[model samples]
Target: MSILPELERRFRRALAPVEEDPDPLLAMIRRSQDPKFGDYQANFAMALGKKLGRDPRQLAAEVAGRLSVDGFCQPPEVAGPGFINLRVRDDWIVDQLTAAIGDERLGVPAAAEPKTYVVDFSAPNVAKPMHVGHIRSTSIGDALARTLRFAGHRVVTDNHIGDWGTQFGMIIYGYRNFCDGEAYGQNPVGELSRLYQLVRRLIDYHAGKTRLAPLAEKLAGLESRLAEMHAEAAAEGKTGDKRVKKAIHRQQKDIDEAREELGELRAKLEAVEQDPELSKLAAEHPRIGQSVLGETSRLHAGDEENRRLWREFLPPCLAALGATYKRLGVAFDHTLGESFYHQRLRPIVEELIAAGIARESDGAVGIFFEGQDAPMLIRKKDGAFLYATTDLATLRYRVEAWQPDAILYVVDFRQSLHFENLFAAARRMGYERLELKHVSFGTVLGEDGRPFKTREGDAVGLESLLDEAVARARKIVEENDDAKPGGAELSPSQRARIAETVGIAALKYADLSQNRDSDYVFSYDKMLAMNGNTATYMQYAYARVRSIFAKGGVDAEALRASRPPIFLNTPAERDLALELLRFGEAVDYCLKDYRPNQLTSYLFELANCYSTFFENCPVLKAETPELRQSRLVLCDLTARTIQKGLGLLGIDVVEKM
Candidate 1:
C-alpha cells in the first residue's frame, strides 16, 4: 500500500540485471531538491557508468528503456548529464492519497531493529523554584522522548534530581536557625525557601570578611606553587641533566614564593590574635564557619545522615517534579538521583584505588585521565563526595540496570564538560558498549537578547508564564469571535477551553518551531499570532476544513465510501496533493532529527497549498460530483494530517475559530 515502497520494489526488479547494489535505485525515488530539474532525477547511472567504465548517456538510456514503472509513474526519460528524470503519473498520486486516508501508520514503517534508549533530562534541584532556564531541559527533553518513541524505540526518561550535596547542609543549618515553627508547620516549601534566603544572606555577610580571607590566600599560594613546579618541569625537559641545577633553583624559588605568601597570612593572623575584638570576630567567623560544613564534606565521603536526608527528600522532590511533568505532558520511567548510587560509590572508589587509576593526592582520591589536564576528584581533601562522584555512580547504574543502546543526557551546554568527563571515565572503565550523547541547547533569550526573564530581569517562573499564555489566548480568541457563527455566544467554560487549546498550542509550537540549539526571543505576540508557523495557524487550518465538512453536511465515513476520481493535471491540485502525500515523510524526517520544526514547516506549506487550491479550484461548487467528492476527501485528509501532526508535538486543535 506504500507508494514509495512499491516504487522502490519496481525500481529494484527493473534494475536487477544491471545493478548489484540496491542503494542506487532507492536514491532515485526521492524528490529533486531543485524544482528546475524534473520531479525526481536519478544520478545513479553516472556513478554506475563511472564504475563500469561505460558511456554514461547510453547507460542511462538503457536503464530508462528497461523500467516497467508505468502503473504508478510516467515512462522514464533521460536528461542532461545522463540523469533519469522521473515524472509521477496523476493516477499514482490519487491512489496513494486514497490509501493514506485509510491507513493509521500513513504508510511509514517502524525501524527494523529498535534500540532501548535512556534519556536523562529536566533535572532541577529540590527546594529551588523552577525558572526559565529549566525550559530547555523540560521542553527539549519531552520532544526528544516523543521523537524516539515515535521512531519505534523503547525510551526511558530519567530526571536526575539535584537532591543532595552542600545545599542540604545550608538547608539543615538555616532550618534550625530560622524556622518559624507555626509558619513552617503550615507550609514546608515556603519555610524551606525562607531558610535558603537566610542562608544566602548569611553567606554574603561573611564572604567578604577578613577572617575568611586566609583561605583565599592559601588557595592562591597552592596555585603559585603548582605553576612554579610546572615551569621547572618544562625547563628540566628542555635542558635535561645539563640544566638540572637551574631546574632545582627554579623549583626552590617557586617553593620560596609560595612559602612567603603563606607566612604573610600567618603573620596577619598572629597580629589579629593579639587584638581581643578581632580575635573574637575571627573565632565567630573563622576561615570557615559551622562544623556542619563537614557534613557536605562527608557527603562526598558517603556519610550516613547525609545519605538518609538525601533519600528522605529526593523522592518527595521528584514527586513534586512529576506534578510539573503532568502539566507539561512529560513522563519518566525511573528516577536515579545522586542517592541512587549511594551503594555503588564505595565499590567504584575501591575499584579506582585497586586498579591504580586513582591516587590519594592531598588527602583526596582522584583519577587523572589519559589526556585530561585536570583530575576527576572522587573525594575532596576533607574526605567529601561531590557531584562528579554521584554522576559516575549514576552512569554505572544506568548501564548495568538497562544495558541501553543509547544514553542521552538532555542537559544544558554549560554541563558539556561534566558529561564529557563522565563519558570519558565510563569509556575508560570499559563501558565502550553504550552510546553516550549529550543533547545540549542554547538559552531562551529575552527582548534584550539575554536569557528570558520577567520585567524585573529575574528568573521567570514557569507556571506564571503558562498562565500569561492562557490569558493572551483568551483575548485573541475573543477578538476573532465574529469569524465564527456562535463563537461569541459560547459560555465562559467553552471559551476557556478554546483559549486553553490555542494558548498551549502557541506556547509549545513557538518553542518547538525554533532550531533546537539556538537561543530564541520569547515574544507573546509572535507566538500567539494566528498566521505564519504558529500553532494557531495550524489550528486555523484544521478549523477551516471542519467548517467545510460541517457546511457540506458530509460525514467523513460517507466521503471515504469511494476514492472519488482525482485529477492532478492542474498545478494547484498537483502541488496540494504533493504536499499532502509528504505528511508521512515529514513526520519521519522530524523523528530522524529530533526536531519538530520539520513538521511545522511541512504543515505551513500544506496550509499555503490549501490556500492556493481554495482560490483556483472550487470544492463544494465543483462542476461535477466526482471532482467535488474528491476535493472533500482532500480537505478531510488535510484536517486529519494537521490534527495528527500537532498531536505528536503535544499541541491541540480547536474546531472553530
Candidate 2:
C-alpha cells in the first residue's frame, strides 16, 4: 500500500481516542509542499483545538504522542501553528524499493473492492470525418480505461458513435444529388466525405446569407450601444467607478462578439460566391437545411432506399474509423453506435410517456425539469425522435447489458446541459443507484487561442493531424540520430519506427498532460520538445536509465535475481527512491478523480528525480561494489516505474529515444 493510506490509518487510530468523528480529519494528512518540512504534513491540530477550546500546540503534542509509526515513518515533529510533519524512514523506503524491483506491477496493489465501469467515449459522427475536437474525448477516455483496469477494475469501453445523426442525412442527400459514381466506386469513404462536406458547405452558405442582414444589424446596434456607454462614462466622469467601468467593458465585449460573428458570416458567404460551382449549388439548395432533415426523417422512419444507403455507407465509415483507432492505439470492447438503438428509441419514448416521466409539450414529447425554461425534447412535433430518445434507449440498454456500477460519458463541455438533463431524466426513470458522470473536457485551441481549425475554417482532420505530428517527429528523430556519438547507428527502418512511436506518444501526452476541464493551446514544438513534462522527456529518461545497463554490460535479470539491497546513500538517491515507492499512491490519486494529468504529473516528477539522481550519483563507478549494484537496482526501478506510468496513460515508451 502507499505511504499516505498507511499513515492515514495510523492517524485515524490516533485521533479516535481524542475526537468522536476523526474520519474527516484524516484528509489533513497530505504530502508536504516543501521536502524540508517533511514527506507529509498534518494540520488538523488547529481545527481540532479550535473545536475543543485547547491550545493547538498542546493538542498537537497529544496527537503526536498517540500516533504510532514505528516501521513506517520517523517520530512526528510538531512544527509551527501545530503542524505535524512526518517523514518516511529511509529504511522503509529502501525496503519498499527492494520489494518493488521483483514485482511486475511495481508494488502497486489492486483495489480491494473493484467495480465495473462503462466508459463511453470517442463518439464521432460516422458520416463526417473525425476532427481535432475528437482527440480530447478519445485520449482521455482511453487513458481512464487503461488506468482503471491497471488498478484492477472491470472496464467496458463503448464507442457510442454518431452513426444515425443528421450528418448521415447530409451525406444521403449529397449522394443522391451530387455524388460522382466513378469516384465513389474507387473510394467510397473519400467520395462520401466529399459529398458530406459539399452538402454542409451549401447549407452553411444559405444559412449565412439568410443571417447576414440580421447579424449586421445586431453588430450596428452593439456598436451604437458601446458608443452611448462611452459617451455617458466621459460626460459623467464615471470611468473610474467600478460599476460604470464594468458596464462599459460588457458593452465593448458585446460589440466585439457581434462584429466577429458578422465578419465570419460575410467571409463564409464570400467564399461560396467567389466559386462558380459552389455558388450555383448554394442557389440550387436554398432550403438545404430542411431538405437534410427531411432525408434524416425518412431514414429514421425506415425508408427502404435510405436504409440500404446507410448500410452501404456504414462499413466504409467504420473501417476508416478503425484505421484511425489503430494509429492512435485505442480500442473499444463494444462499438454500440446510435443506430444500434434505432428500433428501441420509439419504444423508449412511449415508455417514458407511460411512466409519466415525459409528456406532450406544444406537440412535442419532452421531459421537463424543475426551474428550467425548456424541456429536454425526446420527439419533435414532426413525429421524429431526437438524440435524447436515443440516449435514453442507449442508457437502458447498457444498464441491462453491462450492469455497470458507473457509466462515464467522455464528451466535450459543450454538451454539459444535455448530459445534465439526460442524467436527471434517467434518475426519474429509477436508475438512482448507478453513478452517471459526464467526463466533460475543454477544447483544443490553436496558438491563436481559437478552436484549432484549418485555414478554410474547417475542423482539422484527425488522420492529417497524426500525419503531421509523425512527420515532424521523423525529422527530429533523423536529425538526433545523425548527431549521435557513434555517427548515426540507427538504420532507416529503426529511425522510422522510433519516429512513429515518439510522434504518437507526443500527441497523446500533449492531450493527456492537460487538465481536462481547461482549454489548452496545442503546440507541436512544445509537446515534441525533449525537456520538461513532455512524453519525449519521460521516454528519454527511461532510455537514459537503460543506457547505463547497456554501457556497463549489466544483466538486469541477474541484478533482480540477486535481490541486492537498495541503499539511499545520497539525498538525490533518497528522493528518487522515495518517488519510486510512491508509484501506487500516484495511481490511486489519479483514479480518485479520473484525471490522467495527475499520473502525468507523477511520471514527470519521477523522471526529474531520476535525472537528479543520475547527475549527483555515479552508478557505474561507485566507491563500493555493493553501492554500485544498489544504484543499478534503483536505476532499473526508476525505468520500470516510468514505463508503467506512461503505459497507464496509454503512451508507449521506446527502449531508446
Candidate 3:
C-alpha cells in the first residue's frame, strides 16, 4: 500500500475524537507546498482557532499533544501560523523506496474499490479522412486510457464515430452522377475522393439559386441598398459630419446581417469557383441549382437514391477510417455508429413519450431540459430521427450493456451544448447511477492561429501529416546512426521504420504534454526539438542512460546479476532517488485529475534530475569497485524509469539518439 492511505487513516483517527470540524485536519496533509518544509504539513490549527474559539498556536499545541503517529511519521511539530510540520523518518523513506523498487507497481496499490469507466473519443465521421481536428481527441483519449489503466481501473475506450450524417446525401448524388467506374474500382479512397469532388461540383452547380425565389429578390435588394449606402458613406466622409460616422456604423451592421443570408450564397459560389461546368450551369440555369438541392435534401430525408448511395459509400468510408486508426495506434472496443442506434431510436421515443418527458414542438419531438432555454430535438418535423435520438439511444445501450460507473465524452467544445442537454435529460429520466463527463478540448490551430486546412481547402488529412512526421524522423535517425556493425550501413526500410516510430511519438507526445482543454499550435520544429519538454528530450535521456549500461555489458537479464546497495550520501544521489520514488505518486495524480500533462510534467522533472545526478555524481569515475557497481545499478534503474515513464505516456524511447 502507498503511504497516502496510511497517512489518511491516521489523520482521520487523530481528528475523530476532537469535537471540532475535521476538514481542516484532513486538508493539512495536502497543504504542504514543497518537500523542503517536510514530506507533509497541516495548517489546521489556524482553521480550528476560529471554529474552536482558541489561539491558533495554542490549538495546534493541544492537537499535537493529543495526536499520536507511529511506524509512519515522526511526532508533529507546531510551527508558525499554527502549522504542524510532519516529516517521515529517513528510514521510512528508504524503506518505501526499497519496497517500490522491488514491487512491479512501484509500491503503488490498485484502487481498493476499482471502477469500470467508459471513455468515448477519437470519433471521426465515416467517408472523410481523419484531420487535424481529430488529433486532440485521439491523443488525449489514449493518454487518459493509459493513465487510468495504470491506476488499476477497468477502462473501456469507445470511438463514437460520426458515420451517419447529411453529408452522405451529397456523396450519394455525386457517386451516381459523376463517379468514374474504373478509377473507383482501382482505389477506394481515391474513388471516394472523386465521388466527394463530384458531389461538391453538384453542390456548386446548385448553390447560387438554392435560396427561395422571394428571399433571393429580397437579398438582391438588400445588397443593392447596402452597396448604395457604402458609396454614400464614402462620399459623405468628405464632409466629416459626426452623424455620418454613426450612420456608417448602423449601415455596416445592416450590411453584415444581410451578408450572413448570403452564407448559402458564398458556399455555393465557392463550389462554383472549383468547377467550370457547375459555374456555367449556375449562371445559365438557376432552377437547376434549386432542383439539385431539392434532390439532395430528398435523398438525405430517406430518399431511395440517397439511401442506396449511403449504403455503398459507408463500408468503404469505415475501411478508410480504420486504416487511419491503425496508423495512429488507436482502436475501439466496439463499432457502433449512428446507424447502430437506429432500432433503439423508436423505443427511446416511446419511453420518453410514456414518461411525459418529451413533447411535440413545431412538428418535432423534443425534450426541454430543466434550466435549458432551448429544447433538444430528437426527431425532425418530417418524422425522421435526428442525431439527438441516436445519441440518447447510444447512452441507453452503454448503460444496459457495459453499465459504466462514468461515461466520458471526448468531443469538440462546439458540441458542449448537445452533451449538456443529453446528460441532463438522462439524469432527469433517472440514470443518476451513471456519472457523465464531457472532456471537451479546443480545435487544432495552424501557424497563423486559425483552423488547420490543406492547400486543396479541405481539412488536413491525418495520413498526410503522419507520413510527413515519420519521413522527418527517418532522416534524423539516419543522420545519427549510419554503420550497422561490420561497416555495413543501415537499410532504407529500417531507417524508415525507426523514423516512423520517433516521428509519431514526437507528434503524439507534443499534444499529450499540453493541457487538453487548451488549443495548441502544432509545429514540427517545436515537437521534434532535442531540448525542452518534447518527446525527443525524453527519448534522448532514455538513450543516454541506455548507452552507459550497454557499454558496461549490463543487460536486463543481468540486472540482478550483481547486488549493489544504494548509497544516498551525495545530494544529487538523494535527489535522483527521491524523484524516482515519486513516479507512482505522479501516476496517481494524473488519474485523479484526468490529466496526462501532470504525468508528463513529472517525467520531464525526473529526467532533469537524473541528468543533474549523472553530471554531479560520476558513476564511471568512482574510486572503489563497490561504488562503481552501485552507481551502475542506479544508472540502470534510472534508465528503466525513463523507459517505463515514457511507455506509460504511450511514447517509445530508443536506446540511441
Candidate 4:
C-alpha cells in the first residue's frame, strides 16, 4: 500500500465514532502540496468539527493523540484551523524500502478488480503512407495500453485502419492511367502514393475549373460593368440626375457581391495550385478529373478492374506502414480495417430503418434525434453506407467478440462530434452495455502554431522523420562521447545502434511527455536535448547508474536475484526511497485518466530524486559495510525502476549512452 492509503486508514479508525461522512474525511487525506507541510496532510478535523459544531483545533488534537502510528510516523501536527500534518518516521521509510526491494513489483500492487478494455487507435489509410500526423494516436494509444496492462488490465489494442474508402477509387484510376511499371514494381508504396497524389490533385483541379467557370465569367462581366459605372459616376459626380446615380449605386453593389464570390473561387484554385507538383501534374492532365468520377462510380459498383487494382495495392502499402510501427514499437492485437465491416453496413442501415430509429429524409436514410438539428446520416441518398454506419457495425462486432467493459477511440479532437453521434446511435440501436469513450488528442503543430507540415505544405512521412531524428541524434552522440580524438572506441555499427535507440526514444518520449489534450510544437533541438525532460536525459540517468555499478563491481542482477534488504540512513536516501516506492502509485495515477504525461512526470521526478541521492550519499565509500550495501540496493532499485517506468511509456533505454 502507498503512504496515502495507509495514513487514511489510520485517520478513518480515529474518526469512525464522530464522523459519518467518509468521502469528506477521505478527501481531507491528501499528499501535502509542499514538503514543509509534511509528507501528507489531513484536515479531517475541520470538516468533522463543522458537522459536530465543535472547535476544529480540539478535534485535530484528539485525532492526532488517538492515532496509533508509533513506528510509521512522527506525532501528527495540528496547525491553524485544525490542519493536521503527518510526517513519516525515518524507520518507516527504511521499512517500506526494504519491502519494495525484496518484492519484484517494487511494492506496486495489481488491480484487485481488473477490467477488459478495447483501445482503438493508429487508423492510417491503406494507400497513404503513415505521416507525422499519425504519431500522436499511435504513440499515445500504445502507451495507454501498456500502462493499463502493467496494472493488470486485459487490454485489447485495435488498429481501426482506413482500408475501404473513396480514395481507393482514385488510386485504381491513377494506377490504370499514370503508373510507371518499372518504378511501381520496385517500390509499390512509393509508386502507388505518387499515383494517388497525382490523381487526387487532378480531380480537385478539374472540379475547381468546372465549378468556377460560370462564376469566373460572371465576375468578368460584372467587372466590366463596374468599370463603366465607376467612370460614369466620376463624370456625373455632383450634377447627375437622381435616377442615374441610384442605378449606378445599385449596379456597383451587385458587382461587388459577384466579385466576392469570384475571389473566393479564385483563392481555392490558387491554394490547389500552390503545390508545384500538383500544379504541373494538373496542367499536364487536364482531363483526369472526369475519369476519377467514372472510376469512383465503377468501383462502388464493384468493377472488376478497380477491385483487382485495390487488391494489388493494399499489401505493399500495409507493409510499408508496418515498418514505421516497428520502429515506434507499436503493435495491435487486431488490425480490423474499414473494409472488414463492408458487408455488414447494408444490414445495419436496414435494421435501423426497420426499427423506426431511421427514416428517409428527402433521399437519404438517417437517424433523427429529438433535440438534434442534423440527423446522423447512415446512408447517402445513393444507396451507399456512411462512416457512421461502418462504426455502428464495428461496435456490434466488438461487443459480441470481446465484450469490453470500455471502448476507447483514440482519435483526433476534430472528430469529437462523430463519436458523440456514434455513441448516441449505438445506444439507440440497443447496444449499450459497453462504455464508449473518445480519447481525443490535439494536433501536432509546427513552430508557427499551425498544423505541422513541410514548407511545401505536405505532411512529412513518418519514415523520413525517424531517419532525420536518428541522424541528428547520432551526430550529437558522436560529438559528446568520450571516444579517442583520432577514433572512437565504439565501432560504427555500435554507435549507429545506440543512436537509433536514443533517436526513436527521443521522438516517442517527446510526444508522450506532453499533456495529451494540448497541441505541442515539434522541435528536434528541444526534444533531443541532453538536459531537461527528454529521453536523452532519462537514458543518460540510467547509464550513469549502470556506470556506477560497473566501476564499483556492484552486480545489480545478483542483487535483484538475491533480494537485498533496502534501508535508508540519510535524508537524501529517504527522499529517493520514497520516490522509488511510488512507482505503482504513479502507474495507477497514469491509467486513472489515461494520461501518459502523468507517468512521464513521475519518471522525471524519480530521476531528479535519484540524482540528489547519488550526489549526497557515498555508496562504495560508505562509513560501514552495511551502509554501503544499503546504498547499493537503492542504486539497483532505482535503475530497475527507471527501466520499468520507461518501458511502460513505450520507450527503451540502452545500458550506455
List per-prediction Cα lDDT, in the order shown: 0.74, 0.91, 0.74, 0.83
For candidate 3, lDDT tens digit of each residue in 190-261? 777666655655555454445545556776776687678677867766336678667766766776766675
Q: Order of all candidates by TM-score, from best down to worst?
A: 2, 4, 3, 1
Residues 1-657, candidate 4, lDDT per residue (tens digit)? 578667877887887777776766876687687899988888778778888899999988988888878888888899989989988887787777777766767778788899999999999997887889998998899999988888889999999998888778778878887889999988888998998877776776687788797877887887788678768767868337787778778877887888776776677579778978668877877877667767766766778877787788888888988888888888899999988888888898888889998899979998887788899898998788889898999999998899899999999999998999999888887767778999888998988898899875579888898998899999988876656454555667878989999999999999999988988899878887757888787788888788779879887767766655566767788888888767887887788688899999989989998888878998889888777888888888888888889999898988766
TM for every model, in the order presented, reads 0.79, 0.95, 0.85, 0.88
Task: List model 1 lDDT by residue over 1-657, tens digit each.
Answer: 444556677778767888788775576566667765656667777778888899889988997787787776778788888888777777888888878767765545666689999889888777566776787677767777776776678888888877665677666666655578787677666677667655653454344344446656665676676667667767668535546657656666766776665555555455556768556644564433354476556665667776675555555455666776677777778776665676777788878788876788878888787777888889877555767888888888888888899988877777788888888878888889888988777778887886786653358877677788889999878777745655465567877888987887788788888877787788878887767888888888788888888878888877777657666757888888878877767766776656667878888888888878878888889888878887888888888878877777777788876
Cα deviation at 574, candidate 3, in Å, is 1.7
Tens-digit lDDT track of model 2 for 1-657: 578888888998889878988877887888899988899999899999999999999999999999999988999999998999999999898888888878999888899999999999999999899999999899999999999999999999999999998998999999999999999999999999999999999999888878888888888888888888888889999879999999888888888888888888888889999999999988888899999989998998889999999999999999999999998899999999988998998888998899999999899999999999999999999888888888899999999999999999998999999999999999999999999999989989999998898888899999988988898999998898889887887888888888998998999999999999999798888887756888998998998998899989999999999998888778999999888878988888888888899999999999999999889999999989999999999999998899899988888888765
TM-score of 4: 0.88
lDDT of 3 at 480: 68
Question: Candidate 4: lDDT over CA atoms?
Answer: 0.83
RMSD of each: 8.4, 2.3, 4.8, 6.2
Best model per lDDT: 2
Superior by lDDT: candidate 1 or candidate 4: 4
Model 4 stretches astray by more than 4 angstroms: 18-28, 43-68, 210-290, 431-433, 483-489, 561-565
Worst window of 10 by summed lDDT in candidate 1: 201-210
Clashing pairs in 1: 297-384, 300-384, 300-385, 301-385
User: Highest TM-score among the candidates is held by which one?
Assistant: 2
Q: What is the lDDT of candidate 1?
A: 0.74
Residue 25 lDDT, candidate 2, scale 0-100: 88
The residue ranges of model 1 lying beyond 4 angstroms of the native Cα positions read: 1-29, 34-36, 43-68, 78-83, 181-183, 201-205, 208-316, 352-371, 454-457, 483-489, 561-569, 614-618
